[model samples]
Target: MTCTEEAKAELPSDARPEIKAYLENFNSYDTIFIGYPNWWGTMPMCMFTLLDKLDIILYNKT
Candidate 1:
């Protein structure tokens, strides 16, 4: 199952489409620099989701 499908299952009707579109275009960057302050001994879920959705093939080929 893709992230879009999984995200849709968790989110409500209105937000699913935008979230899916973000994930689909998430791989457009060649290199991403994620800078986030650790809060309560944990990074944000959004960062993890971005990393999880990125395509590894772009790095491997370069």
Candidate 2:
């Protein structure tokens, strides 16, 4: 399936899995490594979902 189709199907829905990995204590680390394949010139919709769930602040990223 295409990214557009997948986004339409998954973005508006809650089918994304819960995030089970963390830094033991999130604030314990000042850095994070997020890796994803560049699909269709951008990260996947699931990545957005994960980012939203993590509530990361873009300004805080270094």
Candidate 3:
């Protein structure tokens, strides 16, 4: 489940825990692919927002 920003603003802090919990279940896959088109040599602001909002450790096992 990927989350996209519908509005150009930060999401509420409460949304983080739920997203972290969801990413924690990613082990069910053998490989996870995160693709993004290069924008000014960086990912879109939305991807960074998603990354910063989640717990990296939960996804570290993969």
Candidate 4:
């Protein structure tokens, strides 16, 4: 709730926060949906943290 406000301010800095969720076989999944709060015309920096942790090179090609 309150973090949204803080995240908005931190977006400009491109901060990659360490997300609490973890996936061992990220690449094994055939499909994955990435949903996030859109602030400042983009996803939160926390999204980048999860994205960066996942093997997203071959993800979502449509």
- The Cα local distance difference test for each model comes to 0.49, 0.63, 0.49, 0.77
lDDT of 4 at 62: 48
Better of 2 and 3 by lDDT: 2
Q: How accurate is candidate 2 locally (lDDT)?
A: 0.63
Q: After superposition, how far is residue 35 of candidate 3 from its true place, in Å?
A: 0.6
For model 2, residues 1-62, the per-residue Cα lDDT tens digits are 57467666664564554556644455566788999987556666667767775676343665
Provide the TM-score for each candidate, comma-separated.
0.39, 0.48, 0.40, 0.70
lDDT of 4 by residue, 1-62 (tens): 78878887788888887777686776678889989878788888888878776636455644
Top-lDDT structure, candidate number: 4
What is candidate 3's local distance difference test score? 0.49
Collision count of model 4:
0
The lDDT of model 4 is 0.77
Better of 1 and 2 by TM-score: 2
lDDT of 3 by residue, 1-62 (tens): 13344222334422322233435555466766778866445665656656664446444556
TM-score of 3: 0.40
Cα lDDT for residue 46, model 3? 59
lDDT of 2 at 34: 92
Cα TM-score of candidate 2 = 0.48
Ranking of all candidate structures by their TM-score, best first:
4, 2, 3, 1
Candidate 1 local distance difference test against the native: 0.49
